[model samples]
Target chain A: MSITVQGRQAATTAAPAPPGGRSRGPARVRWAAVAFVAPAWLYVAGFYLYPLASSIRMGFQDYTVSSFYTGVAPYVGWDNYSKVLHDGHFGETVLNTVLFTAGSLAFQFAIGLALAVFFSRRFPLGGPLRSLLLVPWLLPLVVSGTAWRWILDTDSGVLNHVLLNVHLIAHPVPWLASTHDSLTAVTLVNIWVGIPFNMVILYGGLQSIPGELYEAASLDGAGGWQRFRHITLPLLRPVTAVVLTLGLIYTVKVFDVIMILTQGGPAGSSQTLTTFAYNLSFQQLEFGRGAAVGNLLIGVAVVFAVVYLRATREQRQAGR
Target chain B: MSRLLRTSRLFRPAARPGALAALAAAGALTLAACGTGSGSGGSGGAPDTLTEIDYYDAAPQNTQLPQILDECGVRNGVKIKHQQVPRAQFMPKLLQQASARSLPDLALIDNPDLQQVAATGGLVSLSKAGLSTEGLYPSIAQAGQYQGQTYGIAPGVNGLALYYNTDFFTRAGLEPPTTWAELAADAKKLTQGPRYGVAFSAVGTEEGTFQFEPFFWTARGNLKELDSPQAVKALTLWKDLVGSGSASKSVVTWTQADVNDQFMAGNAAMMVNGPWQLPTLNADKKLHFGVVPIPVPSPDAKPVTPLGGEVWTVGHSKPAREAKAVAVVKCLLSQDESAKWSKDAGYIPSNQRAAAQLASADPQLAAFVQEVGTAKARTTELGTAYPKVSQALADAIQAVLAGGTSPGSALSQAQSAAKN
Candidate 1:
C-alpha cells in the first residue's frame, strides 16, 4: 500500500522538479517497487530463463551423454540444426504437431464454449456439475494417460467391448497400437484432458458478463441469437483472446500425454517435436540435436507470445 | 471515451494484487513440489560410512535386497546408507549425479546399461579396486566390462524363457513344444474363446526387445545387422502369432508385467517372461505355470536368450570409500550370500558353481540357469550402440505386429534408421 502511495507521490513530485533533481524522486520509489517484485523475478529467471538460455547454447555444441559428465562439449555452429532439419522424420513430425495442436484446440474450445453457455442457464445441481468437470484438470497427466491407455486397449478395453456389444462396428478398432489410429486416439485423450481447463475459464468469463445487458438487449427486440451475436460475443472477446492464446502455448508443448500413451511409436507416426526431442536426448543420447529441436519448439512458443502481446495491446488501445 | 477507458474493467488494478498473490502461491507450490531430495547422509572421503543405490522398488527384491545389504554392510565394517529409486528414473538420476560428480559410493546398474555408464569414465574398474570375480559366469562378468576392463559384477542374474500354464497343456493332452513349429500348433490348439494361446511383451521398450531376442539370436540375428533374414524370421514369428489371433494385438502395449497379468487372469495359456515373474505367478495359488527354454526355429537350434540383471558397481570415490564399497560387493557376491539372494530374489546365482547346486535343488530355475551358459550379453557386440539398435528393433516389432507392416521391410527400415 505504501509502495503505491510512494510511487504516486514520486511521480507528482518529479514533474515539478528541475531535470537534474527529478531523478532523485523516482529513484527512491523505484527501489521500493523492485523490492516488491524481487521474489517473482528470481523465480522466473532461475526456472525459465536460465534453462532456456542453456538449451539454446547447447544446441550449437557437440553435446552427448558423455558430455554431461565431462562438461567438455565443443561448439560446432549450426551442425545440430542441420542434422535436425535434414532428418527424414522432421517434416512429418512438424505436420503431426500442427494437426495435434489445431485439432485439440478446435474441439476443446468449441465443446468448452458450448458447455459453458449451457451451464450459464443455471439448473439443478449446476454448481456441483461444474466442480465435477474440473476433476480431469486436477489429476496428474501421467495418471490420466495411464487410465486412458487401459480404456483404449485394443483387445480387452472397455471402449471396444462396449462398441462391439452394441454392434456399432463389426471389428474392434486398435485405438493405441495402430499407426493410423494412434494420432487420433492421443488427440482424443488430450481433448478430454484439456476440456475442463477451457470450461472453467470460459465459465468464469460467462459469469462476469452482466445479466442486465441480455435483459436490455431483449427489451430492444433482440432475439436469442441476435443478442448473443451482438452483446455476448463482443463482451466475451477479451476472454476468448486470453483463452485461445494460452491454449495455443499449452497445446504446443503437450508431451506427457503422447509419451505415456504411445511413446510416439509405431514407426514414429504420432511423434511430435517435444517427444522427438526427448527421444533424441534420453533414448539416443544425442543431446545437442535434442536441444536444437527444443530451441525450435521455443521459436514456436515465442511466435504465439509475440502475436498475443500485439493483439492484446491493440485490444486495450481500441477500447479507448 | 477517456473516462470509460479509465474506469474500464480491463484496467482493474484492484485485481492485480490478488493475481500476483495467487501467482506467488503457485510458485511456492511448484517450488515445494520440485524440492530436491534431502542430501544423502554419507559423503566425500568418509571412512566410516558409504552410500549405495539401486532400483529395486518391487517385491521381493525390495524386501530381499535390503536384508542382504544390511548383512553385507555389517560384514564390511561400515554403515551403508542404501537408497532405492524407481526403475524408470534410475538411469536418468544416475546420469544427473554423474554430471554433478556426486554419484553414490556403489550403484547397482542394469547389465545392458553397464557399458553406457562405464563409457563416461566415472566408474572405478573393479580390478583396479582389487575386486575379484573368480567364480561368476563369464558372460555375466563380461556384461559388467567395457573395453576389456571389468567395472561391475552381479550376485545373481536372470534370463527369458517360455512359461506355460501346465494345466492347459494337461487338458489339451499335449507336451510343451521344443521347436517353433510345434509351439505354434500347440498355441493354436490351446487357444479358446476370448483366451489368447500366448502372450509376450512387444511393447516398444527394452523389455519387448528382451523377449524378442531368444528367437532373434536363435535364428542368428546379431545386433549389427537388424535387417538380416534371421532377424526377419524372428519378427515374422511374432507377426504370425498376433495376425492369427493366438497372441492379442495388445501385446504391442503389454509389458512383461502385463503379460504375466494376462496369464494369471486366464486370458493367456502361455507367456514368454523371466524368472522374475516366478514369485508373482506362485503368489496366485490357483495358477500353475512351468518354465522351458524358449523354443527355437528347429529342435536342435540352440536358444540364445539375452542375459538380464543388475551388476554391483563401484562409482569413483575416495580410495577408502571405494575399498569399503568393494568389500560390501564382495560380501554380496560370496557363494553362500549369492545363493541365498538367488533363492529369495528368484534369480539364478551369477556364480555358476552355486547356480548349479541351486538348480538341482529348485527345478523352477533350471531352464534360466541353463540358458545362462548360452545367454548373450546384450552389450557385447555393439556396447553402448546396443540401446539405439534395440530401440529400432523394438519399433520394428511394433510396426510389424500393430501397424501391419511386413517383417522384411520393417526390419530393413529399422536397420536404416539405426544406421543413421
Candidate 2:
C-alpha cells in the first residue's frame, strides 16, 4: 500500500539512488533542488527561528514593559520558571489545560472520524454537503466566539432560552459567568471549532485509502462492522496519527476562543497555559514569565510530536 | 484529508520536523518585524510631517480626533498622520513602537497609564517642550506629572457618574441615592422581576477597577491599603447588591459597555459608567436617564472618581521635531480648543475655565464636570505601581462578586499580589 510506502520513506538508510540513466544530471538536479527550497528556508530562518531564539533568550531574562524599550533585561537564569511553577494559580491552570486538551481532543476526533466515515458514503450532493461543513472552520474565531457568547449569555442567551422553553432546566446555566461551568463551556466551544478540521482531514485520509481493499474484505464474507474494524481502521492509521498529532498540537495551545469567552477569569478558573502566558506577558507586563510559560507550552507540543512519530515508526517497522 | 490538506496548504501545511522549523522561523520573523523597522520615527530635522497615534478607536473621538489633530497640524505647519489602534492594543503597540525606536512624534495615552509609560524614559516631558499645565483641573494635572516632571497634558478629562433610569426611579417614587444606605435600600426596592436595580462592571480588567474607584475612594480607601476596613465597606456594598438579587450576578463579567447596554435595555435601573458612553446613551431617545455623582459612603463624604481621558504627549525626538510636536499638542489643548472638544465630544474639559463656562451651559455634563473637579488620578498615589494594584483590585472584585469570596480575604489576597 502507498500508505505503508509513504510511512516507510522516513526510515530509509540513505538517500534513494538516482535512476541509472540520470547519473549525468545528478549534480545539476541537486543544485536545482537546493534552489527550489532555498526561499522557504530563508523565510523560515528570517521569520521563525530568530524570534524563537530571542524568546528563549528572553525567558532567562527579567523582561518587562521597560525592557521592550530599553532592550536590557538582566539575566535571571531559572528564576522565571521557578516563579511560574510556584505561582498560586499554576496548579489549577495546568490541570485546566490538561482537561481542556483531553476533552477537546477526544470529542473532536470521535465526531470528526464519525463524520468522515459518514461522508465517505456516496450520496446525492455529498461533495457539496461536505464542503458546506467547512463554514465553522472558515469563520474567524473571534466572530464565532462572540456569537457563542451571546448565545450562551446567562441572562438573555438563546441557548438558555431554548433550553428553558423546552423545560430542560429550572434555571439558566451560567455558561461564561460561573467558574464551575466556564471551563466546560469553553471546552465545548473549542470542540465545535475543531470538529470541522478533524472531519476534513480524516475524510481525506479515508479517500486516500483505496476502495479495493474494502471490496476484498467483503469478498472474504466479512460483515460491515467486521470490514471496518479489520480493514478501514488498520489502513487509516497513518491518517489517524496525522489527525491526532495535529489536533493535540492545536488543542493544547487554544487561546483566542478562551480569551474571547472568559479571559481566564471568574478568578482564573478557565485559564489554560496559553492564556496564562499571555496574561503574564501582556496583562501583567512580565514578559520573562510569559516566555517561560510559552516555552513550557512548546515542551508539551514536543512531547506529543515525539509520541506521534514513535508510533508512526513502530507501524513502519511492522510493515517492513 | 485531501480537502483539508488543500486548504491547509494554501495557508500553512501540517508541521513536520522541517515544517516546524520553517514555521518557527516564519513566526519569529513576523513577530520580530512587528517590533522592527522604525514604523514611525522623527530624525533630526524640521520635518514637514509628524506621525501621531492614539487609542481613540471609537465613535465621536475617533472621528473627532483627526479633525482636531489636523487643525493643530495645520497651525504647526506639519502634516499629522494619525493612527488609531484598538484601545486594548494601544499600550502594547506603543511599547513595540518604543522598543523599535519608532515612537510617533505625537501620541495620546490613557491618563492613568501615562505614568507607567513615562517611567520607561520613553516620553519627552511636556514641560521641557514649552507646554504649560496651568488652568487644568488639579487632579487632571496630576495625571500628567510623573514624579516632578510633567510628561503628558490632556485637552479634556472624564470621570464616572451615576446614570439612572428616570422612568424606573419615577415608578419606584425614589430620588437618586446620595448615600450608601439610600443606594442599597433603593437598589433593593427597585430591583423587580427581570430588571437589576444597579449594574457596574467588576470584570477582571482595568475597566472593572476603574468603575470601583469611585466607591473605593469615596469610602476613603486607598489602593496601597486595599485590605482596610474602608475598602472592605466599599466592596461589601457591591456584594450586598448582588447578594440581595438587586444586581445581576453577571456584573463580574460585564464591561462598562455591557452595563450601558443593560441600562438601555431596561435590565439595569442604574449604572456606574463614564461620559464616553454618553453619545451612545443619547442615541436611544426613549431611554430617559439622569446623571448624578456616584453616591458616597455618607452624605458628608467626598466622592472621588477616577479620571478618565487620554493625554497627548510628545515621543522621544530631536529638538526640531519635538518643538513642532509640542506645538501641535499645544494647539490641541488651547483654551478654546479644549472647550470645543469638551462640548463636541461630551467629555469634561481639563481647562478649568473652559470647564466652568460649559458646566453652566451644558447641564448634561454638569455632574461629570463637578466630579472631574475632584476626580483623582488613579496613578497619582501608586504611580507606575498602579497598574499592578489595579489588576489585583480587579481580580479581588471578581472573587468577591462572582466567586463569593469574602471582601476582606479577597482584598488581602489582592493586596499581596500587588506587593509582589
Candidate 3:
C-alpha cells in the first residue's frame, strides 16, 4: 500500500512539469519541489488569505456577539460600510490617519537618507555609530512608546524639565493630554521609531551602487551636490520607492505606539482608521462596522502596492 | 535565475524583519479572532474536572481566587482548572470561546457586562440551576439578571469612593468633602507645587465612565438623557476642576490605577477610586489614606455611585459538567466563603449581613459598604445598551476635560453618539 501511494504521488508530481521531463530523477526533483513549496502555500492560505476573506465577508454582515453564538450573522450588504462612512467621527479619523502617515513618511525618509549618506563616508567610529542607530528599530514599539509617554507627560516629564531649563517655552506642553497636541506627539514618536528602518534600507541600497560611478562623476569635474543629485538620486530611485511604499503600509496601520501612548484619544483627536476600527469592533462590539473600516485601510494599502509594482515594472522595461 | 533572485531580494529588502513586525502588529485583532476553535471538553459521560475562567489577573485575587476555587472543587468531588486573562481581553476571549462552544464550565464576569454576555445566550440561567440571590444586595442581584432571568451571581461587589490622603487633609485642616461646593473649595486649597488638588480617571474607556457616574447620578443626570441640563452640570464640575488646575489636565489620560499611583506619590491630595485599591494601598506602610463616599451635588442629595464587581456564572455545557460547576459556585458564594473572599480580595460582601459585619470590623471598608446599599447597577436602566452610553459618557468626559469643549456641547454630542 505504501509503494502504491508513493507511485501515485510520483505520477502527480511529474504530470505538471514540462513535456520533455519524465525521467525518475526529474520526477523525484519535482516531488522535492512540491515538498518545499507546500508549507509556504499552506501558510499563506491559512494565515493571510483566509483571514482576509473572512474580514471582507464580515464587513457585509450584521455580526455581533450574539451572532457568534448562534452562527447566524445576517448579511446587510453595504449597510455597515455606509454607516461608518457617514458617521460623524469618520471624517476626523481619516484626516488623522492621513496626517500621521504623511508626517511620519516624509520625515523618516528625509532623516534616513541624510544619515545614510553621512554614514557612507568613512569616518572614525562610523561603523559603531551606524550600528547603534539601529537600537530604536530593534526595541519593541511598546517599550519605545511607553518611554515616550513618560517623556511627554506635561507636568513633570523630562522633556518639559529640559525645555523649562533651556527657556524653550514659558510653560510645559500638554503632549498626550490635549487634543491639539496628541496627534503631533504620536506622529513624532512614530517618526523616531521609523527612522532607523528607513536608514538601514537606504544604506544597503547605497552600498550596492558601484564606487566607480562617483569616480567618473568626479573626473568630469562634477561638484559634490551635482554628483549626488544627478548620479546618486537616480540610482537610489528603486530603493527609495520600496522604502516609501513599505513605510506607507506600516505607518497607516500603526496601532500600538498610539495605543500605548494616547490610546487614540484625548477625545479621539489622535484616532486613526486602525484604532477607530478596533474601537468599533472590540469596544462597542460593532464587528461589522469595524471590519468595514479595516477593509478601507486594506484598500489604501492595496492601492499603494499596485502603484509600487507598476512603477517598478516601468523602470525595468525602460532599463531594457 | 540569479538576476531574478536578486530582483526579488530587492523587493524583500533588508527591512524584512520590520515588515514582518508590521504584519504581526496589524494582524493582531484578526489573529485573535482566528484562534483555534476545537471543542476542548469531555466528549460524554460525567467529567471529573471542570474549567473556570476570570479576569482576576492582579496579585491577591490572582493567587487567592484559584485557591478558593480549588477548595470548592475538592468539596464538590471534582478537580478544577482555572484560567485568567487580562481585564481588557476578557470579553473578547469569552466571545471567542462562546463561538466555538468550548466555553469554560464556570466564568467570573464583570457585573455591567453580565447583560451583554447573557444576551449572547452562552450562559446558563443560574435561577433555573437552583442558584438564589436571596440575600445578595439588590443592586448586585439586579446587575446579574438579564430579561428577568438570573444568569450570574456575585460572591462580592464593590463601588467607587473618594480616597484622600489623611495626612494632606490634616495638614490643610479640612474635612473630607461631603458636597460639591466643599469638594471644589477644598480641592483648590489643597493645590500647591507639584500637587494637584484632586485626581481621577477621565481616560476614554469604561473606567472613566465608572469614575464619573457617581457625580453624574448625584447631580440627577439620567443615562437615558445624556444631554439633559443635569448631565451638562455633572460634566461641568469635572471641566471646572481641570480648568481651575485643581485637578491635573492629565486626568484626561489617567486610568484608575494611574490615579492611585499619583495619590500614593503625593502628587495628588485626593482621588476618586474604588475599594479595589485597598490591598495595594495597605501594602504601603507609609501612606495614610481614608475612604469616603464620593461627594454629592448637594448636602441633601444621595450619592449614587455605580456598582462595580465581578459575578460568578455557569456556562453552557454538558448537564453533568454544568451541575458540578453550579455546585462549585454555590460553595464559593456561601456566607462564610463570601466573607472570606471579600476580605482577601478587598471587596464588599454581596450579602448584607456579611457586609455589615465586615464594615464594622474594617474602618476602610465602611464607606464602600455604606455606598453599596444605594449604589445603582449600571445596566438596570439600559440593559445591554449600557456599554455604548458608557463609552459616549467617557468620551464626553475626555472632551470636556482635555479638548476644551464645553460640557453642554460635549454631552450633547455624547447624547447623539449614544443614540446611534
lDDT-best of 2 and 3: 3
| C-alpha-based local distance difference test score of model 3 | 0.88
lDDT of 1 by residue, B85-173 (tens): 98767887788777766577789999999998998888889977777778888988889998888998988999999989999999999
Please state every model's RMSD to the true fold in angstroms: 6.9, 7.2, 6.8
- lDDT order of candidates, best first? 3, 1, 2
Give me the runs in candidate 1 sitting further than 4 Å from their true place. Answer: A1-40, A208-231, B1-46
Q: Write the per-residue lDDT of candidate 2 for residues B1-420, one digit (tens) a residue.
A: 234323334232233456556566666466667654433344566778888888776678788888888888888788988888887778888888877666788888999888878877888988877778887888878889987889999989999999999999998899999998988898998988888889999889898999999999999999899999999999999989988988888887798878988999999998898887888889889999999989988788879999999899888867787788888888988887887787667788898878888889877788998888888899888888888899889889888877779999999989887887
Residue-wise lDDT of candidate 3 within A1-320, one digit each (tens)? 44345656777776676677556744444444444444474467558876888899999999988988787999999999999988878999999999999999999999999999999999999999999999999998888888999999999789989999999989888999999999999999999999999999999999989999999999999999999999889999988998999899899999999989999999999999999999999888899999999999999989999988987888789779
DockQ of each: 0.27, 0.27, 0.31
Candidate topping lDDT: 3
The TM-scores of all predictions, comma-separated, are 0.90, 0.88, 0.91
Candidate 3 lDDT over B270-349, as tens digits, reads 99998888998999999998999999987899899999999999888778778878889999999878988998888999
Q: What is the TM-score of chain A alone in each candidate?
A: 0.86, 0.83, 0.88
For all candidates, the clash counts are 0, 11, 0
Error at A100, model 3, angstroms: 0.2
